[model samples]
Target: MSDDSSMLLDGLPVAFADGQTIMEAAMAAGIFIPHLCHHPDFKPQGSCKLCTVKANGRYVSACTLPAKDGMEVENNSPDLNDKRRTMLQMLFVEGNHFCPSCEKSGNCMLQALAYELEMLSPHFPEFYPDRPVDASHPEVLLEFNRCILCELCVRASRDVDGKNIFALSGRGITKHLIVNAESGRLADTDFSLADQAAHVCPVGVILEKRHGFAVPIGSRRYDVEPIGMQVERPATAGTPGTRDEQA
Candidate 1:
């Protein structure tokens, strides 16, 4: 018979409450499962597919897959990691991510994951898509070139900020992030730097102006510790549910 409150994660026992997803259970147990689109504060969106794991011989998104008693989840396997590496590489090349110059470098989940997954280079040809840099907002800057389409901003804006200032448009390779304004400008919306969406981005897409490199390169969040370790330690996740908690 299956235990009602526990399961096996990678051959290790893990206990979880009812209604917790595999990712949530793993996270509560301090097990690192690579993910991009799922954050604790928002409803799980499984859009990134980085958290896909083998659950009882079937592949499913850990973020959205409910944790069942006695279920065995395969995470961190070589096959899974290899696939995740390829996905990370695709994300890197799909967007214009100049990490060295990005304000979000050490604090960026994507860059940190690339290092964690040992993705040395963007394995595919760069699209180098012509995106815009919207500095129309005085306190914040929107660099669309580095957006990975994780929709953190979209969820945060609509759910938390209640502005619905950001949204994803188009489809597939043509899909891109868009400001929900008639002029296609962030300033045209009521997005403020204080909003939750402004701080939830995993990449360099949304940044604050006039504060670039304020934390320095080497002393930043992921610079001091890998993302996995940070996730395991909530105290170091930044601001106790405000800053970098989604990271």
Candidate 2:
């Protein structure tokens, strides 16, 4: 695929390859588009809807939508941000995200994006689902309460680690992450700390047993910089504060 195509991301021109998705092009050009399930390392799962943007008048998931030449995309608009903020609030309320007490506080992508999107509160009523915690694994801990259904761990486990340790069950709001074992425990499965699944969780769901608070609050990944800056992108000459751009 040739890398000669170009598109307008919020009026700024972004060059893309023939097969590159809008998200890929934007990121390559150092344009931050907020997302959770569409990691660059994994297949683009458009389940999280967080990367939805207006492309040529219609809304589409930037991570899944292929970039076209001369396409006009609106990313940081007020309406789009408003919708994203609502989604963030719902995600917060859907799970028991006690960010202060959680081990993934400063390093969590969800938490960082919430702050970036200016999510002041979990606007809707909280679900507070009584999910189980799996401490049966010798080296890893599984907190179901923090699962955002992003399926990053599932992908990592199946595709990268080839362990198939994780899967999702149920439907709609009842859908949840489940261990791929008859015993329904992490210990029953071959989930190792070395597996990509152990480190791919954007939230506090899949965690190590004793590594809590190893990094201080102010020095964690997102603590040092925002989530938008977590991924390395090509630096543009004029955009001095591209990292601080509206994500």
Candidate 3:
């Protein structure tokens, strides 16, 4: 497939490649689109509706929808923006996302997206779900209370790391955390400290040991700007300031 085929997104003519998804094409064309589960290195799960776009007047997940020639895609329309904001709000209230206490406050994707949409407060009431925190691992912690269940970590663990240590256990609002193979803690599971899932989390739910509170909130990565702004930058160059030796 050619890398420069013409397509129409939101009534605007744009160039797209045949293999790229709608989100990839729109982002390559400098269009700002919101999404939660669409990581560049992982397969598209299309679980999050935050990146929904109108293609030929039908709503579809931009992360999974391929950009075909002559397709009309709407990305930043007012209605879509509202829906994205609302979905973010639901995520905010569904978990224990207390920005004041979280170490990943500034670097968190969910927090950054909320700020991008100017979500000053959660419109929905808090779910206050009581979930257990898994800190049994020597180098990782899993705080189920703060999880938004975007599933990026799951995919990273399963597909990228070849470790099926993480999986969604329940259904709907009653959903809770579950370990792989058995009901043991992450430490007992097949999860290794080197798994890509350890770093793909969008929230503080999955934290690295000896790394929490390493950087102050004001000095964190997303403090400079929204994550969308850094998406196009080189990963190393765009990373937030870290106290680690690698930084």
Candidate 4:
């Protein structure tokens, strides 16, 4: 590969360092790439394909794909947009996303992305997957029914906090709740309020107990604008580290 540090992403040239991923590069260039699992404070797990983009004539997860010199990337192509819409629809049907009742309705990333894609109604039949609510902890609420399985909290717990508290269980459509350690309760687990996992949940599934109804609908950050437009990439640090380093 060439030693150049810039690449053309959707007709716009963006510069990136040697180790930056395509998602990071695109964000740095002010290109909005819709994502749920990729958070700046957490490690990139790439579980959700919402950030999928065409690079060098191939589909790749921007969160995991390394940006290469001279590589051509198409982020907002018709095909990709269609795929994203379909994916969002599937996510909508796969879980019980009742926005009106959700505490995180306005600030939720999933809702914001769905609105951005214009998913007014879920066209597919509801999965209606039965998932138990785990509200054992006094400070945390675990509503498995609303989880998209984006694994943001899981990754944040495991990688950033070095506390492997949250983990997904089962496989395929049967995939259900997350277990926190052997006891399967947040309180029983070694997780603390300080753990990044507690704050990384994109949905209202895992929420801080105190802030349940703190922010009303239509007043939250994502409610005003899509997360892509609301959040800006912070200045990159000169050190080598995980996404937490940048934040």
Top lDDT model: 1
Candidate 2: regions farther than 4 A off: 1-3, 233-247
For residues 1-247, what per-residue lDDT tens digits would candidate 1 score against the true structure? Answer: 3345788999999999888999999999999999888888889989999999999999999999999988999998999999999999999999999998888888899999999999999989999999979989988889999999999889989988899999999998899999999999988988887787887888888878877666778977889889878655332223554343335
- Against the hidden reference, what TM-scores do the models get? 0.94, 0.92, 0.89, 0.88
Worst 10 residues of 4 by lDDT: 238-247
lDDT of 4 by residue, 177-204 (tens): 6776567777787666667676667777
Better of 1 and 2 by TM-score: 1
Give the per-residue lDDT of model 2 (tens digit) for 15-70: 99888999999888888899888777787989889999999999999999999999
Error of 4 at 22 (Å): 0.9
Alpha carbon deviation, residue 175, candidate 4 (Å): 1.6
Clashes of 4: 0
Question: lDDT of all predictions, in order shown?
Answer: 0.86, 0.84, 0.77, 0.77
Candidates in order: C-alpha RMSD to true structure: 2.5, 5.7, 3.0, 4.6
In candidate 2, list every pair of residues with a backbone clash: none
Instruction: Name the Cα RMSD for model 3.
Output: 3.0
Please tell me which model should have the higher lDDT, number 1 or number 3. 1
